[model samples]
Target: MFLAVGLGNPGTRFERTRHNAGFRVVDILAERLGVPWKSEDRFSWARGVVGDKTLYLLKPLTFMNLSGEGLLAFFAHHGCAFEELIVIHDELDFPPGVVRIKIGGGVAGHRGLQSIVEALGREDFVRVRVGIGKPERRELVVDHVLGVPEKEESIILEAAEKRAAEAVLCIVEWGVQRAMNVFNAREENGQKEAC
Candidate 1:
């Protein structure tokens, strides 16, 4: 069994925000798999099969900062290990429209990731990172992530979200190394090159 967790604040207010990139990717995956989400107390989830693996998609309703709560509950219920986990989230370091795969890394001060690490007592799970870039000023970081993107950036991010969803499928169908080799490539001038 594999659990793919998407971190975000729940509600219409955050639906189109940069911080909800993870949610967007998971939604895309759910649609492609033709699975319907069933709401629980701590989170919403859908189940489907990819290859021979049982895939579970989860979106924490505990919001971004407390995302771990929902994940912990799911883990306890499913008795899943950290190795069977994949987290899809927005990346402030990379440019918009970029999607990358990472394994066992620091949280980079992302509250949602930090919460997961705290709950799980590990940081070795796979991650599908959707780039959202960052604000010019450090002080505006919160507002920037919580706010909706501009028209052009929104289009780019939508593409990135779709790519992130593909990355998740690749990881499940193949392996982390293979998915990284494919999705981690950088795009330059409309062409893709190794990163």
Candidate 2:
């Protein structure tokens, strides 16, 4: 079994926030797979088959900063390997419509990823990062991420969420290297292709 964990804060207050992009993508995946989420031990998850692989979609309920604690518990319960895990989260570095896949990298100051690295004791797991561009001013960083997206940005992000779901399937069907090659490639104009 492979684990696909989507990071986000719990509660309706954060439902539509830019920082919850990972949750949104997981929702899209659940929809596509015709599975319903079930709450279980500090997280909610759904199981489905993707190209002969059993995929477990996880959403940590301990909020963003404590996401790793929940994920680690799930991993221990399921006896899953670190390499069989894929983490999906919002990225502040790229534009709002971008999605990228990579394996093992610095967390770029993301507290949720930091906690995951701390708990996992390694950084070699796969990552599927959806972009939610940074604020112009440093002081507005928190507000920018927690705030709801503008109408146009929301539309873009929603579409990106669908793409992110596709990327997850690509990883399951084709492996991370091919998923990265397909999902991380840029167009001629330097825009990322939505794989």
Candidate 3:
């Protein structure tokens, strides 16, 4: 079994914010798979299959800071290993709409990532990063992430969310190495890389 976790704050207030990029990606995946989410005490989940593999899509309701709590509960019940876990979240380093795949790394101060690392006691899980770009002033970081993007940026981000969902599917179908090759290379070439 493979588990994919999308990090974001729950509720309509945060629905379109840049910080909710992960949730957007997972939402797309769920729609594509025609799976309906079932809400748990701490999170919501949808189950589907891809090429004979069962994949669980999770969205924590504990919000961004306490995301790990919901994840820990999921682990306790469903029992998944660190290696089989994939986390999707926003990235401030890359330009808006850029998507990247990574295997284990620091949280880069992302509260959601930090929470997961703390709960899991490891940082080696797979990550699908959806870039939201950074704020001009360091002090504006919070406002930037939690704020909704401009019309043009929203269009870009919407596309990125779809691509991030595709990247997750690719990783499940062909493994992380192949997914990284396809996605990361695409990033460099400024063109879609065939999987």
Which candidate wins on lDDT?
A: 3
Against the true structure, what is every candidate's RMSD? 2.2, 1.9, 1.0
Global lDDT of model 2: 0.87
Q: What is the lDDT of every predicted structure here?
A: 0.88, 0.87, 0.93
Least accurate 10 contiguous residues by lDDT in model 1: 186-195
Poorest lDDT segment (10 consecutive residues) of candidate 2: 186-195
**How should the candidates be ordered by lDDT, best one leading?**
3, 1, 2
What is the lDDT, from 0 to 100, of the residue 161 in candidate 1? 92
lDDT for 64 (candidate 1): 96
lDDT of 3 by residue, 1-195 (tens): 788999999999999999999998989999999999999899999999888888899999999999999998887777765347899999999999899999999999999999999998999999999999999999999999999999999999999999999999999889999999999889878876667
Each candidate's number of clashing pairs is 0, 0, 0
Instruction: Score candidate 3 by lDDT.
Output: 0.93
Predicted candidate 1 versus true structure: per-residue lDDT over 31-134, tens digit per residue: 99999999988899999989888889999999999999989877677677534789999999989988889898999989999999999899999999888998
Top-down TM-score ranking: 3, 1, 2
List residue ranges in candidate 3 displaced over 4 A: 81-83
Compared to the true structure, candidate 3 yields what TM-score?
0.97
Regions more than 4 Å wrong, model 2: 186-195
Per-candidate TM vs. native? 0.94, 0.93, 0.97
lDDT string, candidate 2, 124-144, tens digits: 989999999999999999999
